[model samples]
Each structure stands twice: as C-alpha cells, then as structure tokens.
Target: MAQQERGNRSRRSILEAAARVFDERGYDAASTNEILASTGLTRGALYHHFPSKEAIASALVAAQSEALVVPDQPVKLQAVIDLTLEFARRLQHDPVLRASVRLAVEQTSFSRPAQTPYEQSNATILDLLRQAREQGEVLPGVDLQEATSTIVGAFTGLQVMSQVYSNRQDLPDRVCALWRFLLPGLATPGMLARLRTAPLPQTAPQAAPQTAP
Candidate 1:
C-alpha cells in the first residue's frame, strides 16, 4: 500500500511538472528534458508512468476534462452560468487547465486534434439546454444544437483572446460579458431578468481536484 501511494505521488508530480512546462512552452516546443528537470525524476521513472511526452499531454487533457464541475441547481440555466463562470475563474490559476486549453487550441505534429474535451463540453451544455427548454427557461424557437455550438465556440474564442490580451486575468469579466450578449437569445425574458451576468460570489462552489492516477 505504501509503495502504491508513493507511485501515485510520483505520477502526479510528473503530470504537474509537465503541465507547467506545456503551459509555458506549448507541446511541440516543450522538451521531455525540461519536464524531467522540473520533476527531478529520472527518465526511467517518467517512462514508467507516461511512456512519452504525448502521453503526458493526453493525461493533462483528460485531467482537465474530468475536473469540470456542473452544479445541480433548480434553475438549470443558472447551473450552466455557474459552470462557465467557475471555469473562467479557474483558468486564471490552474496550470493543468491552462495547458489543456493550449493543447486543445494549438495542435502539434505529435498531438492529435483535441476533440474529446470540446465534445464533452458541448454535450454537457446541450444536456443543460435540453433541461432548460423543458422547463420553459429557454426562449421560444431557440435551437439547442445551434445554441450549444455557439456557446462553446464563443467561449473558446473569448478565452483565446483573453489569453493573448490579458493572460486570462480578465476571463471572468469577459465571460460575464459573453453571457450578457448570449442570454437574451437563449433565455426567456423572465429567466433573463433573474440571471446574473456578473461573476458569481467567490464563495460559489469550485471544482474538486482530480485524484492522482
């Protein structure tokens, strides 16, 4: 049991180190040597856990995907808002999430396209929209599929621009602005009036940390 615990710690250390390096240098430009240097782990140890650099990148993506927390709210549309706002706030501080976004948007020769993360996000939003429509929170004639795609695409674009311009320091504000523009088209007038576009209180529940593999 002690040996298994140590192994898990070692693997998490490697992943955190890799995530920092990838966040700073991107996947292709980031070297395995740099990751090794960051972790102070011998090549054998890293290889034992993650056969290659691509493996590390894939793990980071999967980790970020699993970290997303969608709240269970009586108002389903508000749950969607809470999810996006919390994610934007986390993006400013979480190195693993930053690396995941970079990996998803900037594909390299070694990495395949990042479809899984986007697909998962789209599916989650679609599900929320379906529930919202059923509850009459959504505006009439709002196509859930198109709304799902638009929200995901716009959020992605906003984050990319925020990264370039403000290093994501303004992501929460940007996301709030995004929802203000988008909600009118998606939510019923009464629902829209009740929704808050500003960042939720910092006391809002956050995503739980993922367990080490």
Candidate 2:
C-alpha cells in the first residue's frame, strides 16, 4: 500500500511539473529536463512513468475534464452553464487544466486536430442539451448540435479575449454574459426566466425544479 501511494505521488508530481512547463512554454518548447528540474526527480523516474514528452502531454489532454470543478444543478441547462462557469473559474488557478486547454486548443503545435478535450466537451454538452430538451428547458426547434458547437466556439473565443486582456480574471463574468445572451434564444421563456448567471453558493438552498415544459 505504501509503495503504491509513493508511486501515485511521484506520478502526480511529474504531471504537475509538466503542466506548469507546458502552460508557460507551450508543448514544442517545453522539455523533459525542465519538467524534471521542477519535479526534482531523476530522469529514470520520469521515464518509469511517462515514456516521452508527447505521452505526458497526451495524458494531460486526456484527463483535462477531471480537473473541472463542476457543481451539481437541478436544471440540465443550468448544469451546462455551470460547467462552463466552473471551467472559467478553474482557469484562474489550475495550471494542470490550463496546460491541458493550451495543448487542446493549440493542436497545430501539440498534436493532431482530433483531440480528447474537445471530444469530451462536445459529448458532455450534447448530453446535457438532450436532457434539457426532454425536460422542455431548451427551445423545441433549436438543433442541439449547432447549439453545442456555438457554445463551445463562443466560450473558446471569450476565454482567449479574457486571457489576453486580463489573464482570465474576468472569465466568470464573460461566461455569464455569454449565457445571458444565449439563453434568450436557446431556452424556453419560462426556463430563461429561471436561469442564473452566477455560481451557486456551496450550500445550495432548496428550491423548486428549474425545469419547464
């Protein structure tokens, strides 16, 4: 048990170090030596876990969603909104997630165009929209595919601007604005009125279901 725990810690340390390097320098410029320097681990230890730089990056990209701090919401559409909002909040603090996002978006430098993070994001949003539609939160005629694509594209652009101007300090607000604009067209009138643009308090207050049909 102790050996397994130590191995887990070593793997986490290597990943965290690599994440910071990737976030700062991008994949092409980051090196295992830099990652190892930050980790204070021997070359053999790093190779014992991740075989190569690309493998380390691939692991980060594949596990990006695991870093999200999504909170539960009774409304499916609200859950989708919270997902983005949580990601926005995460960008301010989590180096691991930021590196994963950088690798996913800068696919030209990091890997092939088909990436795990985007695929996972699309799947998550699509599933939420499907549930929201069935619950009558989403408008009857809105195509979920288009809606999902638009939300993802919009968030991508929004976060880039936020990162450029404010280092993502303003992302939560930007995300809320994005949702406020999108909700009018995408949600049913009743649902639109009930949706919130802010993060819920940690201790949620009991309320009626946000679903409307």
Top model number, lDDT: 1
Q: Residue-wise lDDT of candidate 1 within 81-180, one digit each (tens)?
A: 8889978877876777777777877763255674556888988889999999999999999889999999888998999999999999888999999999
Off by over 4 Å in 1: 108-114, 203-212
lDDT digits (tens) for residues 31-122 of candidate 2: 99999999988999999999999889877776566654345777999899988987776666666666767777787445466545666788
Per-residue error at 70 for model 1, in Å? 0.8
lDDT of each: 0.83, 0.79
Mark the 10 consecutive residues where model 2 has the least summed lDDT.
Answer: 204-213
Residue 25, candidate 2: alpha-carbon lDDT:
84
In model 2, which runs have C-alpha deviations exceeding 4 angstroms?
68-70, 108-111, 199-213
